[model samples]
Target chain A: DAGVTQSPTHLIKTRGQQVTLRCSPISGHKSVSWYQQVLGQGPQFIFQYYEKEERGRGNFPDRFSARQFPNYSSELNVNALLLGDSALYLCASSSDSSGNTIYFGEGSWLTVV
Target chain B: AQSVTQPDIHITVSEGASLELRCNYSYGATPYLFWYVQSPGQGLQLLLKYFSGDTLVQGIKGFEAEFKRSQSSFNLRKPSVHWSDAAEYFCAVYAPWGGYNKLIFGAGTRLAVHP
Candidate 1:
C-alpha cells in the first residue's frame, strides 16, 4: 500500500502571503498529523485530525490551520506567512489518533522570502 | 513538559563499526519511545519503538534499541554500520493528551559513515 503522500513537494512563497499544503493518508488510515521541520532540526508536531475532527494542536500561532476530509485526507494552511515560517511541512498518518504506528510523508518544502 | 534530548549533534563512524546514538527523555509516566531515521530530503522512517515489554527491541535495517527506565534513556545501536546508514536519527516520545496523542522529537543526530 502507498504511504502518506503530500503535494507541491517544493514551493516558494512571499512574506505575508498564504500557502496550503495537501496530504493524502494511506488507505485505511484514519488519523493525519502535520509537523514542521526547520533546517537542521527535527520535526515538530503542529496539528492532528481524526475522523475529520481536530484532535490536537501544537504551539503554532492562529495563522496556521488544518482540516481533514471524509476520505481522511488533510490540508494545512498558513496565512500571513513570515520568513520564519519557511520550513519543511510534513504530513504523517496513523491508524488512529492514539496509535504508535505513525508514518511520515516526504514533506512539502516551503520557502518564504 | 514532555521532551526528548539527543546529546550528540553529529557522529562519525567507519563502515563495519558498531554505532550507538544516545537519547534521553523526560515524561511523567511510562513513555512510549521511538527511533526514526531520515535521509537527506526524505521523510522520517520508523526504526523501532518501545512501548512496554523487553527493554531490547530489534528494528529494521540491522538496527536495535535498548530502553533503560532507570536512566530514562533509549539509545539506538547498530552492530555493523553501513555507508547507506548515514542519515539523521531522531528520538521521540508519544505524548498522549486527553484522547489524542502526538510525538515529541529530539533535535536529531546526524551520522556520517566513512568508507
Candidate 2:
C-alpha cells in the first residue's frame, strides 16, 4: 500500500502570499496531521484532523489553518506567509484518533522569500 | 507542558558497534513515547514505541528502547550498527489530555555511521 503522499514537493512563495499544501492519507487511514520542520530542528505539530474534524492544533499562529476532506485527504493553508515559514511541511496519517504510529510523507518544501 | 529533549545533536559510531540514543521527556501523566528515523530528504519512519507494557519494547529494524519512569527517559539502542542506520532520529511524546492527542518532539539526534 502506498504511504501518505504530499503534493508540490517544492514550493516557493513571497512574503504575505498564501500557500496551500495537500496530503492524501494512506488507504483506510482516518487521521491526518500537519507539522513544520525548520532547518536543523525536529518537526513541530501544526494541526491534526480526524474524521473530518479538527482534533488538535499546535503553537502555530492563526494565519495557519487546515481542513480535512470527506475522503480523509487534508490541506494545510497558510496565509500571510513569513520568511520564517520557509520549512518542510510534513503530512502524517494514522488509522485512529490515538495518533500513536503515524506514517509521514516526503513533505512539501515551502520557501517564503 | 509536555516536552522532549534529545541531549546529543550528533553522534558518530563505527559500523558493527553498539548504538544508543538518549531521550528525555517531561509530562504529568504516563506519556506515549516513540522513536522515528528519517533518512536524508525522506519522511520519518517509526522505529519503535513504548506505551504500557514491558519497559523494554522491541520495534522494527532491530531497534529497541527502554523506558525508565524514574529518569523520565526512553533511550533507543541497537546491538550492532549498520551503514543504513545513518539518519536523523527523533524522540517524540504523545500526551492524551482533554481528549486531544498532541505530540511533542525533540530537536532530534543525527547518527553518523562510519564503516
Candidate 3:
C-alpha cells in the first residue's frame, strides 16, 4: 500500500502570497495531521483532522488552516506567507484519532521570499 | 507545557561500531514514546515506539529503544552501526492537546558515520 502522499513537492511564493499543500492519506486511514519543520528544528504540529472533522490545532497563527475531505485527503493553507514560514510542511496519517502510530509523507517544501 | 529534548546535536561513529542516541521528555505520567529517522530532505520514518509493558522495545533497521520511566528517557540504540544508518534521529512523545493527541518531537540528533 502506498504511504501518505503529498503534492507540490516544492514551491516558492512571495511574502504576501498564499499557498496550499495537499496530502492523501493511506488507504483505510482516517486521521490526518499537518506539521511544519523549520530547518535545524523538529516538526511543530499545525492541525489535525479526523473523520472529516477538525480535531486539534497547534500554536500556529490564524493564517494556517486545514481541512479533510471525505476520502481522508487534506489540504493545508497558509496566507500572507512570511520568510519565517519557509520550511518543509509534513502531512501524517493514522488509523484513527485514538493516537495510533502516524505515518508521514515526503513533505512539501515551501519557500517565501 | 510538554517537551522533548535531545542533548546531542550531532554525533560521529565508525562503521561497525556501536551507537546510542539519548532522548528525554518532560511529561507527567508515562507517555507514549517513539523514535524516528529521516534522511536529508526526507520525511520521518518510524524507527520504534513504546506504549506499555517491557521497557525494551525493538524497531525496524536493527534499532531498539529502552524506555526508562524513572528518568523520563527513551534512548535509541544499535549494536552495530551501518553507514546507511547515517541520518537525523528524533525523539517524540504522544501528548494530549485540546481533545486529541499529537506528537511532540525533539530537536533531533544527526549521526555521521565514518567509513
Candidate 4:
C-alpha cells in the first residue's frame, strides 16, 4: 500500500498571499495530522483530523486551518503568509484503532518572500 | 503538552564504528516512544517504537533502542555504522490524551558517517 501522499511538493508565495497543501492518507486510514518543519528544527504539530472531525489543534495561529474529507484526504491552509511560514509542511496518516504509529508524507515545501 | 529532548544536535562517527543517539522524553503518562530517521530530501521513516515491552526494541535498518523508564530515555543504537546511515534522527513521544493522537518530537540529531 502507498504511504501518505502530499501535493504541491514545492511552491512559492509572497506576503499576504494564501496557500493550500493537500494530503491523502494511506488506504483504510481515517486520521490525518499536519506538521510544519522549519529549517534546522523538528516538526511542530499544526492540526489533526479524525474521521472528518476536528480532533486537536496545535499552537499555530488562527491563520492556519485544516479539514479532512470523507475519504480521509486532508488539506492544510495558511493565510497571510509570512516569511516565518516558509518551511516544509508534512502530513501524516494513521488509524485510531491501529495504534498510534503515524506515517508521514514527503511534505510540501513552501517558501514565502 | 508533551515534549522530547535530544541532547546532541549532531554527531560524527567513522564507518564500521558503533553509533548511539541519545533521546529523552517527558510525559506524565506511560509514554509511547518512537525513533524516526529522515534522509536528505526525504520524509520521516519509523525506525522503532516502544510502548510496554522488555525495554529493548529492534527496528528496521539494523537499528535498535532501549527504553529506560528510570532515566526517561530511549536511546537508539547501531552496532556498526555505515556510510548510508548519515541522516537526521528524531525522538518522539505520543501523547495519549483527550482522544487525540499526535507526536511531540525532539529537535533531532544529525548524524554524519565517515566513509
Please provide, for model 3 over A53-106, each residue's C-alpha lDDT reduced to its tens digit, 9 standing for 90 to 100.
999999989999999999999999999999999999999999987778889999
lDDT by residue (tens digit), candidate 2, B35-114: 99989887789898888979999999999999999999999999999999999999999887456886779999999999
> Each prediction's DockQ?
0.76, 0.75, 0.87, 0.64
In model 3 chain B, the worst 10-residue window by lDDT is B93-102
lDDT tens string, model 3, B29-101? Answer: 7888999999999999999999899999999999999999889899999999999999999999997867889
Give the poorly placed runs of model 1, Cα more than 4 Å off. none
Candidate 1, residues A37-56, lDDT tens digits: the string is: 99999898999999999999
> Could you give the TM-score of chain B for each candidate, in order?
0.97, 0.96, 0.97, 0.95
How much is the lDDT of residue B33 in candidate 2?
94
Candidate 2 CAPRI level:
medium
Cand. 2 TM to true fold: 0.96
Residue B19 C-alpha lDDT in model 3 = 97
How does model 3 score on DockQ?
0.87
Model 4 chain B worst lDDT window (10 residues): B94-103
lDDT of 4: 0.91
- What TM-score does candidate 3 get on C-alpha atoms? 0.98
- TM agreement with the true structure for every prediction: 0.98, 0.96, 0.98, 0.97
Query: Can you tell me the CAPRI class of model 3?
Result: high
lDDT (0-100) at residue B15 of candidate 4?
A: 97
Report the C-alpha lDDT of model 2 over A1-113, residue by residue, as the tens digit: 98999998998999999999999999999999999999889999898899999988988899999999999999999999999999999999989878557878999999999
